[model samples]
Target: MVDGALFAGPALRRLRRREGLSQSAMAARLAISPSYLNLIERNQRPVSARVIVQVADQFDFDPRLLREDETIGGVDGLARRLSDERFADLAIDRDELNEFLAAAPHAAAAFARLYDNAAPAALRDDPIIAVRREIERWRNHFADLDTAAEALADELRLSRGDTGAALTERLRERHQIAVRILPNDVLPDTLRRLDLHARQLQLNEMLDPASRTFQVAIQIAALEFRSAIANLAAAPQFADPSARGLFERHLTAYVAAALVMPYGRFLRACEGTGYDLAVLGRRFGVGFEQLAHRLTTLQRVGQRGLPFFMARIDRAGQVSKRYAGASGAAWLDGDASCPLWLAHRAFERTGELCVHPVLVDGAGGAPAHWLTMARTVNGRGGARFVVALGVEAHMAADIAAARGISLRAEDATRIGQGCARCHVPNCVQRSLPPHGAVLQFPALEQGVTPFRFGG
Candidate 1:
């Protein structure tokens, strides 16, 4: 079901057994008998839940991870070769493999590598799984920007939203520039740069005010910070041509945000305003979603925000965007469902702000703090995505005024339609996965909610 050799990687096994103590002094570290620990390490006894807890809690191991446990995963020699059939009967040097796995854990991605090689067609057909990795890779690279933004946010002592807007306003004032938006046809998928002196920003001028601000910000980014953005996007993982293109696009957007909200100066505003969305939007001439997107991009190590994470969900459970800060809080795999995702209540009362708090414990089983602010926003016709975040609790007060946006709120935050994607067992509106969660049930049931995913 999973990678075979993953359990047998000796380096991983050794890391598990170390327990933050020398092998000889292991007994003192755990306050347990070293002989018992030896037996456990030598495959004499299966690692129990209690032992797992001790290792994780005591030595800061991710306790919920099952890979270390033989019951869950163990890097045995046989498993390693089985997973890599090329090495089968090829006399693998166990010591060499251990050393390789020890220093370069990610290089030993046997599961996905083997699976991809085994069935090329499967990879092509399953865009959901194929794109999943790419999405996260993009998210990760974008997320790193959080450090710079966070430092700026903290220094400003203002809400991140406020920080972004303030920084944009500062840019406009400092540069004496005007912001404008155009249609998708007018603007390219990413930003462009022309002569600032000629008022020559060729763009999609028909877009909304927020979109306009974003375009200008992107232009400014390309002009002021192209090299920095390029450097960040160029890395080992992003070497592939297609992947690099996607990475650059994502970074271009980020550079736009960064320009609109220079981290150091913007961070001060964020702390000052407590991350008020509307005011911040007004400052930067961007939208609420844009401001929130910038908030999660603060990943500067020492100068950080309250460690906010962001996810955009539509009526259905498809996650359109997920950006996790340095918190290492992985998003749910395969579009994990959340009942609180629906924000129908916000639409009933226009201009009323509401907070529905929910916790997301991902596949790894860690509680992710998410205080999702689900207000309906206007889309092409009906409604669109409900935006929320996993932000720090301390900044809630600053954002209280911004959350009361109800005039544009959609039914259950489904955005654009009542049932476009309400596949909560029986959503009648779902024709497919809007946010891109695979539908598991088409034959077993019919539409129950406003959206359904079964064909």
Candidate 2:
């Protein structure tokens, strides 16, 4: 059932779906020829490293997942069966092979497997995969450790769950790691590793103070809250130990965010700062992207706060992550990926700020409003994050006044597909009501757009 063209097609399609975009819209957003995007999706072309990172930083996607080779039904098994010397005369260069890996994942995996089997007697298992497998087992130990540590977190009023701060103190006093921040390039991408049993934590020294602080806090989280994050992440799903370890590493990042904002402090900051993204970023010592992500996690029952939504993007208009706790309407689940959603405007103005007003009508058929802000950010790479922040419609005016956002949550030069695909009629940007939208149009001319359904 898995063909070469469809090797990674499901993942690619999922990415598109999560953005709430049709293929043509997504292709346009990325500024690539639709044909090119189609080719890549169909496994006719390889996705470049630049595209990989663009999707990651913009949509907060996992680059490795996109680059991952097929673990099953891959041609690598066959390739491993043949000696490299045998193919030497074929003139298929290593770069071309890598291209094949990126483009046709199943075929590449099969080739690697085959090649490894035929490789010299001493070499067979992939060292990277083997090492990661071990890391995964250690991750499970962390779950037990966290259970023991939870009550202590509650007692200290560490509602901020100060894991990173605690870790820094521990490592500096007991282990002497001398935690330092260098440029991300200067440091290893991996969080913490021991050299001669001496812990070393490296980070991008050039980060904005808030971002730098986050990196430091994240390093600390890896040490202090590893158990808490591990406990939550160790659920049985990831089949490979290597994959599981990567999942834990991502959770480590999540824990660090929780520690820095401490949910309690963050919710208060939202009220105090009027849910202003910039002020919240500065107040919590977190970056725009970081604050944006944490905003979505504020739904903790009685201890809960506004279920603010968040997402990120780049100049090319590709989304990195789209999260919403309110409706569980994930952009990743395919709600809104249109280029004209006022979200893409951030890329054009670059440093210039933008505010978008949105109206949301839920399943109950009521309209809610919200005020949004967007701007561009640069980091390890050129123009990395295109930040977007939105708050509840009721708070839109008060928030707009304080944060200098748009008062009219509806009026903007809105054009194109985002608002159009929506179901709510009377929506100005609605090029077409959704599939089941009630058709209020009386005669032929009233309904200017196509889809008019009263379901």
Candidate 3:
């Protein structure tokens, strides 16, 4: 008997429609009242265990399909879209949103699509910023591409060892693309470049084994999973070609991560090893940042892992990448990241494990804190970057890194979401005052920070 909590009414309706059976006809076949079937199809009434059994026995249908919670992803996506600054005035609640999605998923998706077409492009002020946001959105999570990658991982029998060889073999046998490792001089700063006319893929020699394998996997995904990747790219409905190009590149990267780590296996390893990034990286033949980024994507339903927020920042304090896992926290919201974030400090002291406490919205309320561990990673052109992995303070007890770390409220370092939204009254690093807050520059009195914000 399918649980009422798991019943997907929209899915059942679609399945019924696919079988070309009207509500009355389906009800008659199932030996149930047409009104009851109609109510069940509309999600106004739950599907009983007898109804489930009848549907499966009579129609040879997979009952599990009707119980899947695929609408949750749509719900989350809708929530994120509505949280944008443009929709700040929205007064929607979570329960209502979920109900809407559960009952009318197609309508919800159409509404989201309309918002995508009409809502202002993310980071519209700067083209580069807009492109970055679009790319990051897909990088955070693309359900379809990730699913395809997972299926490919299962089909290809991908493992931690000899991934490059396997990918090369597939490229050669399936795509007829030759793989080559070019000298540093020949392929200056590039990681992997495909020569379609020559039927060759050129990768830089300086990259480590895992990196090479990842690049090769990316190449394979580009050629092999082109249609799947392109389909996801079109879903964003990107107006800029460059943004779409960036989406394609990141989609290949996503596929590459899946090829190297292969969702289920990597997620299991993460659980078995307490999510030790170093050990997991070694086991998967990947880098710290690679594993860190991949850790944020263990959002697969039923087979999920811990919720970890990962970010990459440069020495200049510019955030290049951000991903929030199932936590559903909008860690980055277009404001300059707080300078005190451990991701920035990791640059000053490389290779050191720093577990810092941060309050997302500062004091004077129910503070939301997170414990993050930051470490440095080498980037292209001898540049150094910082990668951080963290979870909520409440969930810190579950993480290995946060073990033995202080969880007292006072132990957390006071920090704000960002300069524009931060309410830190005396923050020395305050570059700008909080939006809508009155700025007071007392001519006689001075504080540690540049400007003082009035209450």
Using all chains and alpha carbons, the TM-scores for the candidates as numbered come to 0.50, 0.52, 0.75
Report the error of model 1 at residue 192, Å. 8.3
What TM-score does candidate 3 get on C-alpha atoms?
0.75
Candidate 1's C-alpha runs over 4 A off are 1-199, 234-240, 327-332, 335-340, 344-353, 361-369, 378-383, 392-455
Q: Per-residue lDDT of 303-402 in model 3, one digit per residue for the tens?
A: 7677777777777666777776555455464445788776677777878767897776532334467888889988887888888787887876766786
- Candidate 3's displacement at residue 307, Å, is 2.2
Q: In angstroms, how far off is 396's CA in candidate 2?
A: 3.3
TM-score of 1: 0.50
Q: Write the per-residue lDDT of candidate 2 for residues 392-451, one digit (tens) a residue.
A: 656555563335545564653322224433444444445445543456655746554455
- Residue-wise C-alpha lDDT for candidate 1, range 7-32, written one tens digit per residue: 22333246645545555575455566
Error of 3 at 157 (Å): 3.3
Q: Is candidate 2 or candidate 3 better by lDDT?
A: 3
Candidate 3: the clashing residue pairs are none
Q: Is candidate 1 or candidate 3 better by lDDT?
A: 3
TM-score: the better of candidates 1 and 2: 2
Clashes of each: 63, 32, 0
